[model samples]
Target: MRNLFFILFILIFVSCKEDVLPKPKAYLSLKYPAKSYKKLHFERPYVFDVEKNATVKDSKNNWLTIKYPNLKATIDITYRPIKNNLKELLIESEKLVFKHTVKAEQIVSNDFINESEKVFGSIYEITGNAASQIQFHATDSTEHFIKGALYFYTQPNYDSILPAVDFVKKDIVRIMETLRWKD
Candidate 1:
């Protein structure tokens, strides 16, 4: 009887293990809390113009950014004419970051250099007790920029919401990768 019980338990365990599903695959992934949200759209000039859904609002009707909660995680996805060029855009963007992040610790700047598409941008990560990240992507037709920020109390740095950031970044990349200029 003892041997039969042990065998039965082992079989059950093995079956359960086998039935477990593998982790979900994605361009990016992050852990986050459960909540409800809605999408929003913002209109800028030639700099960035696109529809931004998946937004949360506070009681005061202030826009709550989905990517980062602290500094408007709101994404400004737009297309601009290549008349200015990437070099000038880079300088202007750097100046913007410096002006805004006066109290922030500049994390680092990253670039996505593509010979065929000529896509380029920089990502700035700031650290304090909590951290926030920002990015600026520019092309000839238009520029796509996003400022992602999170409060210290929100999550423990990258361990918690980093995956979500990555997941959303992937989504943004997908959107950019398939971007088409409206004639």
Candidate 2:
């Protein structure tokens, strides 16, 4: 009689408990450093401002690499002298950017022209699983031509790397905006 009474009491209390509720969505809390830039003092055909946190590597043929060690990403830059091949350079740049169409959802092209600086270019912002999230080309239309692309070390995961993309994007834009062709 005592054992039966104890089992009945336990069952009643267990069945009276509240149901578990689902939790709300949560995201990572990432803190980035403040933005600062310094003029690239390297002896090159062109000059631009780079982020203070980045490391610049000089490569053959006036090519440059701006590495963000903290973000594990690099902005590759290729500089070419425009003789009569401006057409070819522009075509090649567009072709390289469009190659990502197989994976990109959409590509946003923004045209920029600075008359005083004689800098004209187009910036392509790609959204999706594309290998390169950003690609751009700038030129003086007479002497200097520059192309750049942004790449992460890790595999493409747009959602996860979106924040880092935005962070480095500012630096890239800074490069474009401050770019000046050297005579």
Candidate 3:
């Protein structure tokens, strides 16, 4: 009976032992495919390079959506004729960007100027949980004005989507760099 009690006590003591060490931090590692771009030529008055993996959907009034189905994101592109409403158009575009300021940590503007291509615009990179991660407007300052915004279909979790956002930002920059207004 004494041996049985000793064995039971030993077992209980061993089972009660606890390791109080803190757990190592864990993070999600996401991998995406190497990016390849193809020139997009539509009947519209503009052309740009887009990721080959994205699908382009045409909407009314020369507006289009570049869908990244795998990433659950889309880039909405709208084309407008300057038509002497340049001020109004500029104000509207800026207003659209500022709307996200409430949720945005910071908004960085990068001027895009290609004298040879006659492309002049600004690209706004918004960091934080904003609805739109990137917004851009490219125009020839005369006839054609095109605006684009990048948005994810999912809730805006900036940390969770950082990788995807960075990937798409590069594509957006490429588009802005290669944009050409049709003569």
Off by over 4 Å in 1: 1-72, 84-87, 129-132, 141-164, 180-183
Whole-model Cα lDDT of every candidate shown, in order: 0.44, 0.95, 0.93
Root-mean-square deviation of every model: 10.9, 2.1, 1.9
Per-model TM-score, in order, reads 0.43, 0.93, 0.92
Off by over 4 Å in 2: 1-17
Give the better candidate number (1 or 2) by lDDT: 2
Candidates by lDDT, descending order: 2, 3, 1
lDDT, candidate 2, 86-142, per-residue tens: 999999999999999999999999998999999999999999999999999999999
TM-score of 1: 0.43
Q: How accurate is candidate 2 locally (lDDT)?
A: 0.95
Sorted by TM-score (best first), the order is 2, 3, 1
Candidate 2: 10-residue stretch with minimal lDDT: 12-21
Candidate 2's TM-score reads 0.93
The parts of candidate 3 lying over 4 Å away from their true place are 1-5, 12-20
Tell me how far the alpha carbon of residue 82 in candidate 1 is from the true structure, in angstroms, after superposition: 3.7
Predicted candidate 1 versus true structure: per-residue lDDT over 79-141, tens digit per residue: 334464656655766675565464555456655554465444445554332334444554533
